[model samples]
Target: MIKEIAILVYPGCMGMEVFALTDLVLMANHLAKNMHPGKFSALRVKLVTLRPNPVAIAGGFKVAAQRLRGKPDLIVVPGLEVSRFGEWDERFARLGQELKAIRRFHGQGTELASVCIGSFVLAEAGVLQGRRAATAWPFVSEFQDRYPDVQIEKDAVILSDGGVTTTGAVSSVMDLGLHLIRESMGSAVARAVSKLALIDGGRVSQRAYVDTALIPQNRAPFSTQVNRWLAQRLSETYNLCALADAFNVTSRTVLRRYRQETCMTPLQWLQKARIEKAKHLLELSSMSVAEVVVAVGYHDLATFSRLFARETGQTPGHYKRLFQGKRVATFPRG
Candidate 1:
């Protein structure tokens, strides 16, 4: 049996997300043929668009997507490069006819899945409305604001609810493809595909990739200075009272202002900043985990390890190993 899958393409879509998923799904089919010849022809993937028109993706390249031939068993909606925070809804709304087509396909029992910011399209189309979904962690706030009924799980790498599946961050689109393979074939096929694709199978969250400093900090001028001050000295010990004194404000005032601007208190931001710095050191420098703990202002290795694991969903060593030579992309937290 051939399981048909459609990968939706549109103008300004993330080319990498679309390309990676297409390759992974095709690789799964290739592996299946070699591993279980004559019995497995698992997936048939199509790059689809609303019409047979050329679409400009994020990069400089342009490609034509195939018009919908028939109702596919699964539809993969790929994310786009969001230049600004509020543009997703407008972009998706302009494709209202396509959104309607997606909903109709879902009505016909075609499973819907979204990658990263593509959740906005699914939500706008009403396919993911009132359901738990996952998308790029940075866009969680805006996504929730746009669709109040949709529960946004920013931490999870992938989430499946009802008939819609969503994956967090840009790279997890490949993970979502592998997940589809696991669902359609089995774990054995999925594992083989992962090995062939060189995809790490342990990515479960987007937390480790989150750069805390990049998170939006809409605050007062004085609070902005304080945030900068905190960023400069992530390795130093911090106290709310001392921070308030250094900034010539009462502790209560400091806490209130920071919370008002950043949506997080000073202490929470400080911890996040430390973790980010630690992540940087672990990835770039050949620092041991214990050295990293002390360098990040934590004295107890066990305490740092626990906090690191809790915040990033990976141990210090595991986190270091994950990005040893890889370039960590900075995702804007809108």
Candidate 2:
């Protein structure tokens, strides 16, 4: 089956995911033709616009887009490069035609999809209204404010709900590509594409990319103070009694309120804060895994490793390597 995909391009669309996803689908086409000619065929893909003009993208690049001809099997709304926090309004003001097209296609039962903040576009078009969508972690607040009717999940890397599929972050483009292949082309072909393109298919969350310090913690005065206190004492052993005394609240009241605010108890919140700090130190400092464990209040190395893996789906060492480490330039000393 030939899956026709229309990549909706707009001014200031992020170019990386657009190019990466197109490349992946093209590779899948090649592999599918060679491997299973009788079963599957080349997927038809087109960069499309409401008008027959070159759409400006990020990095000052432009893509020649064909006038949208027909309702495609899938319409992919590409993420925009938001220079300012409140640019969603500006973006939508210019995308009146694009939004109409999306609404038209979706009403006709065509599936809708998005990459990163492209979910915002779908939300604006009302296709994602009252449906859950996977969105970029950092922009959840803005998305909620704009589209309070839509439910957003920040952790999921890829989500399919109510005939709409969405992915988190810019890098989730490959994950989305692989998911489409697995759903339409079969797992065997998806595995082949994964290996051929060297794209990791194991990513399931945006947790690794999250910065805990950035999460809004000031909804209530008590939660704000608790977060601040926790941030400073991540290296200390978790003591519920001491926390209650410091806040002048009873131990039971502390646990109940913290859980009510964060959906996590005091101990669980402490653990999360510690893991986030450990991730930060590993990415930015020259700290060894053992040192990181100690710095985060974990006494046992094996326990810390297991906890880290459970929390982020990657070992501390692997996470550090995947992020950054203190390493000198090859063949040159600093």
Candidate 3:
């Protein structure tokens, strides 16, 4: 279990990232206390500073670190502003020393992690060389340029190399923490923590949206025609022969071209499109399960349930319930 956690704070650090990490940690600890009772306890977290004085975060927010008496089981480095100002240099140098000390601690079973630009500090400490890591997409080029040995993967929201972990941007840090919590505790505990934090663990995979540019454009003539035809008739069920006829090709040729372009067969793509439409309706409209099934071109509830769960890792009803619950929680009570 992750009993002790330390957060590194320095001048010009991103306040939101630190707050998000701390919030998730607090949620995990709360779940631990509730689940374990007297057998185990909550996670112990502390905000520690390399300098003796309080650190001023970006936008003039000052945070005072409580003194830590011992080494933490996990140390987290939040993003810092890399500037050339005098205070910036002082804090950066102190952060470097702090990272060095944490690396030394890692040599003795402690784990080191970072969020967003914090990876730069870990890289500077020589802990990320040749390690698979990720940071904010905007910093991907700079990080690669600065540390050529580090394998920068911008597509990943979080990457772990041995004991060192790095996450992309401030929001993704919550996913990283949740992942660590799941690994340390169990899925049930992590899910409870996510519920308490009002965070949807499923959104972690949406990090792939940032890599949309990496997807190759669909330029194949048959694929283009099939996609266009399918887009117009998403609410209609079409057989493979019908699809092949529309494309003026044999079924095998159509299947091969579809798979090559979209990495999915014609029927699979159609089902995915329907599922996507169903998800949108679930989010945007108050449709019943039966109605949604028809709206998404599925007449069979069992098949829809199986496909929805397979694609989203949750049943359609469960997804609807979670989404509705989130809206109810966020709406202002009169």
Candidate 4:
């Protein structure tokens, strides 16, 4: 059974990604303690870092490391924002040494995991070769370009290729940890941990946003045209073929271009745009559902309702009620 774990921290790391892993692990530990006292002890966790001080992240957040005496059973490396202006910062060189040392510990049979962009660190170490991995969708192309040997699956939430696990994004780290708990202990334990953490395992897959296929390289022209067209004809009925014809392209080409640029097909994009318009009308205006549907270019109320529910995970009526409730809560009666 895996007991000890460590989470690597460094400057430029995403605060939320690190917390997702630690939160899930801590929840699993808590559930273990509640289920059987003294039977299965909580996993040991250490925040490992290069320096003996706290490191600053992108959004002005800093995290301190907890010193470790020995190698842990698992080590989690959270993602960091890459600087596009040039090569990785010099601070990453020191982090590289820390990663190498952690790998040496992993070579002794300790399992390794990474969250979102943290896969880059693992790729630099040359450990992910021939391994299937996943990272944030936006970085998928860059990651593949940098590490061609690694089989990076774009659709996976949490990929485990021979004990080197990687999650797609920050939120997916929570899913990854729950998966680890299930593997180490049992499904029962994982379910209990999910309950305590208030996470739905089923929703984990739906939240993933990466796509690995070769997408269109340029999107400015397409996005601009689409936005203008969408804005002017909010009440007009639109179709994929019509939009494609307007752009003088085939439907398939339009679909591919849209997917590459926005991570959504034309239809999905239309629905999202419609939903946003509907939300504004519901919140800022006194438009009813029927009027909102017409305003947002939808003729069928049923279709609009279904699409809205799928997009937001709540019925339009329920969303309206919740939004209204929040507004009312903010402005109480005198």
Q: Once superposed on the true structure, which residue ranges of model 3 sit more than 4 Å away at CA?
A: 67-69, 82-94, 107-109, 203-334
Ranking by TM-score: 1, 2, 4, 3
> Candidate 3's residue-wise lDDT over 1-334, tens digit each?
5677888877678888788877887777777777876644666678887776677877778899965447787888888875432233355565666767766776777788898878888887778888998887656766786889999877567888988889887777788778878876778888998888777676543332332233334578877789779879888887889888877889999888788876788787777778777776776788998899998788999999999877666678877775653543466789
User: Which pairs of residues collide in candidate 3?
Assistant: none
Q: How close is candidate 3 to the true structure, as a TM-score?
A: 0.59
Report the lDDT tens digits of candidate 2 across residue range 105-206.
999999988999999989999999889998998888888889999888868899999789999999899998998888778998899999988788988888
lDDT of 4 by residue, 1-334 (tens): 6787788777788888777777777777777778867766676667877666777766878778865447677888888776551244454585766667666866787788888878888887777888999877667777787889999876567888887888876778778788878876678889988877778786444211222222334347886577667667767877777888888999899878777777776666666767877876766676787888888988888999888776656677766775643443366689
Q: Write the per-residue lDDT of candidate 1 for residues 51-157, one digit (tens) a residue.
A: 54788778757888898768888888888777776776568766777789888998898888888888888888888877999988888888888899998888989
Any runs in candidate 4 off by more than 4 Å, and if so which?
Answer: 19-27, 52-70, 81-94, 102-109, 137-155, 206-223, 238-334
Clashing pairs in model 1, backbone N/Cα/C closer than 3 A: none
**What are the TM-scores, per candidate, against the unseen true structure?**
0.87, 0.81, 0.59, 0.65
What order do you get sorting by lDDT, best first? 2, 1, 3, 4
Backbone collision tally, model 2: 0
Q: Of 3 and 4, which scores higher on TM-score?
A: 4
